[model samples]
Target chain A: MRHGRRRGRLTRVSSTKDKLLDATVETLRTHGIAGVSARTIAATAGVNQALVFYHFGSVDQLLAAACATATAQRVEVFHERFAEVGSLRELLAVGRELHTVERGTGHVAVLAQLLAGAQSDPRLGEATAAALDMWARELETVLDHVLRRTPLAGIADVAGLARAAAAAFIGIELYEGADPQGAGSALDALDQLGAILEAFDDLGPVASRALRAKVRQVTSK
Target chain B: MRHGRRRGRLTRVSSTKDKLLDATVETLRTHGIAGVSARTIAATAGVNQALVFYHFGSVDQLLAAACATATAQRVEVFHERFAEVGSLRELLAVGRELHTVERGTGHVAVLAQLLAGAQSDPRLGEATAAALDMWARELETVLDHVLRRTPLAGIADVAGLARAAAAAFIGIELYEGADPQGAGSALDALDQLGAILEAFDDLGPVASRALRAKVRQVTSK
Candidate 1:
């Protein structure tokens, strides 16, 4: 409890904890939630098995901590980049990159694992909810900007729009992971919307409408 | 080995198998994949524990069969009804209904449980992929008809549009289920789109564009 002297032990404790957490995440990524056990995690961390109980108390606690830590890290990776985007189109591109496992945050697979277990495990469910809430909060800001600049403004509830778009981004990732063709069609449609929105923004309202009539005539064929 | 002689036991055997499968689905709903076991399912089905393996060979095979059967039944519940919808508006409404746990298919929760395990288990992953494919195929047909009737038709790749829409529908459901706000925002935005599209369809292309511009002007203020 001595202020300066215990600081050394605290540092040692924190580092050991970090290593254990890292091993837990690695296990989740490679073996999944079911594969995570004190033995395997300690083996992966190269720590004495007793140290796991000393640090985290149980495998479940270690997993919950791993999920929080991994989710927080992923949020940091995307948050800085997404917050800087000036338009909806840029956000979608970043989202596309983040959703794919081979390309970006492999968090989706881990998230799916948590979500599945969350329905039955209250602690895991709360963790899953907190992670989703983090996403929804970030998206609301971007959608506010996109709506204010576009011809589609006032078209719906802004809050709802943000949530829906956020949901679609996640939905795309989950479906793609399962489907392999992924959301190729949905992303294509999104790209078209970005192009159209960019063009329509430059055209002004009256001209944009006039252009739509022409676009309809062409697309209708 | 004669085909006709064992038919009586065949009928009783198959009935017992069906009951075990039904118990598996119910257990998945109440407890989750991790909670499924011969003991739990046999108790739920009011049968002897050995009967589980005797009927399905193993707990894993029983769970897989349960997933497939439940998914097929849910798909049947929504499929023909969706195929008959007259417009995008109707499709969205139906999709919304099908996504929720209380109001629609409880498959979302079951699917979530499967997807979580799918990452670690090759067999579970394959089963999940097949189930999702069934959903996408049905949604594609509905979107094809909706796109054909709307001004948005031919604006982009119809296949992608269908897939993206299907993804969004799914994304909304999953997020809502996890978050507990119930997809209010996503659904609200969808309803707005439905309103806008319905209005646009009736107004003719030129007028609809004019109306959208006016909407922008109002929203911009």
Candidate 2:
């Protein structure tokens, strides 16, 4: 395998893949999925078209690899930043960080293209969906841990609630990026997250108690 | 100028425009934005090459017009639905209706295209931004009226909250639609909306007190 041929050339092999992924992200950023062609990606990566094929097998495969790389990075960041928050309030703070990086850094742009492409391309859709599910599960674990420590009435519903929260966060991220000026200052994103956390804090004791109990059951078991 | 045309003749005149818009939606739906082209739209619409210009003035204008037409109808539906909801829960029920239709219909396919396109296209970005703002405002009005007597603290924040809520709703709409399974059942969409509203409701005293005060302030002013 080329993996063996490149034993001492680890940097070269990795750089080739990195260059290809970077080029893919740029292509998606500028041209979107439709505008992404093997030739364009090869040109952007400064490699021969054949080299691209050699590394990734095909254009579609190359795109999937690029998207997978981006998705994994986002998941890692989300987990790294959000994994320690022990309460909903703390999680809202995490939301601020995620939203800032997602909108300001062009991460969402790449995801958007990949997501849109996923509509027509099943392989892409499956890969993206799997990444999303992984993110959700990671968050759920955090939620389960928190609820177990502080049982609330609605705790059993924590997984569903967590999924909804994650979905809402992504939605705000997309909307903010789509129209930066109208969405207002970056602080507005934080404020929005604060409002959601505040609302959750306001829940009735019965609901809260139920949440706590349910989450404890799920996580402890 | 052609407003004077009789309904029968109007059909003839507008058919080209309608076809163009329909074609734009179709092109957007199948291929997403990057694949959308004036020539492809023209061919899809079955219009002569020059007619796209005759009807929409430019390709950009054509895309804008199509997006406006697609978004406007939903806005109209939203406006009508809110008029009937007299409380926060009821207002959310109305939101559920809008979400149901938006998710179930093939509208999301085109919407995803418009959103992805908006990332790179300035004109489209402005148009998409404006549409979302309009939806947010409508939601604010509904929340204010429903919580009119409540004590919720953020009347001024109503617009922001409404925007956030709508963003969440829309994010799910677009994401679910683009998924391999396509739209989920209407009950599924409504159930998600219900969970969000339930979370707000659980916030109970805090939400009520803050909202009531905000409502009073707005109504007084």
Candidate 3:
């Protein structure tokens, strides 16, 4: 009896709900929060407007669920990759790679806009916190490995470093939402730093230690 | 006759408009976008709901104007202070001081939410651009002078650096809108860099040149 197949329940909004969630994500990117409403989102989803309240109760809850679903999927995928991170160099490289696709798909803007929206809505605030918590955990895994190679590891708070890195990524993406043209120069600076970091990677462990020694000297003064 | 003071129009929404804008700001802070409406805003402003349409044409336009007005005022204050920045150290110090007050006043989150909302509405989009442009110009002035002091002066692109710094500030503030406690560590890293830069400041031109030479070694490798 436990292994026997059972008929799917008719109560769940699985097929219709999935459509609504997808529509919510797309609407958020194109129209933003103000433009989102039961009528608009239902039209996009090709469903009746009445079903919006019937299925989700309200527009706010629908949008929050969309954000949470999208973010959770991305986090799961990234965490799988993060689990194998071997160095700080590889960590940044992975970031650069993801930035490319996420930007193209509007994922970056969706997350950024949702974060801004989260401040205004309690349901969204809760969803955003869960998303950030997932990211923080993923980053913590990478940072643990990264700080070990650097000379400042002893003084650096590993958890704080992870949080800061996560913050920087979110910050950079949000800034990009406001100014697209300004992005090239900003990305260029980061690329240059990435190249410098790569160079530090090519050097042997002894040289890496010496370089961090220099960083320690600069930071101490 | 032209110089004579004209009697103020009794029907004008100028006083009422200001009151509505102020109410919008408060509503945005406490209720987010979903709570904002002609009814709620008017109730908060203690005015007739129909006046929201009479003065601003739509709620979207009213919110846009409120954001633009708040941003322009903040820009003017910062530009006055930025004009005096001769070094990067002073720039960060001023930023740190302003961050404390802006957070308490909820100005940071207000601007951030409006920015995300801006993406949905064209009028808000235009206003946000103007605000960002003003901030960019102010930052350029400081970066141009600051770049002259360090080794990066010769190698770094002043305009590019200015844009990156501007993007970083926006990004940092936006991130803080979602995560308040996480700010101190991100800011701490910047302060550590600030201290590093201050050391570069204390060194004379000869030492500065030597430091740049040292930087050239690590980066070029």
- Real contacts retained, model 1: 0.55
Q: Rank the candidates by DockQ, best first.
A: 1, 2, 3
Candidate 3, residues B1-221, lDDT tens digits: the string is 11122254354344777788878887777666646788888999999999999999999889888887777667676677777777776888787877776776666567666677766666776766666666667777777777785656665544555656555565566556566666566676666555444444444565555555554653454
Q: Give all TM-scores, in the order shown.
A: 0.79, 0.79, 0.77
For model 1, residues A1-221, the per-residue Cα lDDT tens digits are 22122345544344767889778777766776656678888889888888889988877677777778777777777777777788766876776667664234467666655665566777776777787766667777777777676665544356776677767776666666666574676777666555434544554566546544543442233
Supply the global lDDT for candidate 1: 0.66
Error of 2 at A46 (Å): 1.8
Candidate 2 local lDDT, B56-155, one digit each (tens): 8888788888887777766776677788888655665666676667655556557656767776677877777777777777877887876565434344
Ten-residue segment with the worst summed lDDT in candidate 2 chain B? B180-189
DockQ for each candidate? Answer: 0.33, 0.31, 0.31
TM-score for predicted model 3 compared with the true structure: 0.77
Each prediction's total of clashing residue pairs, residues at least 3 apart in sequence or on different chains, is 3, 31, 0
C-alpha local distance difference test of each model: 0.66, 0.64, 0.67
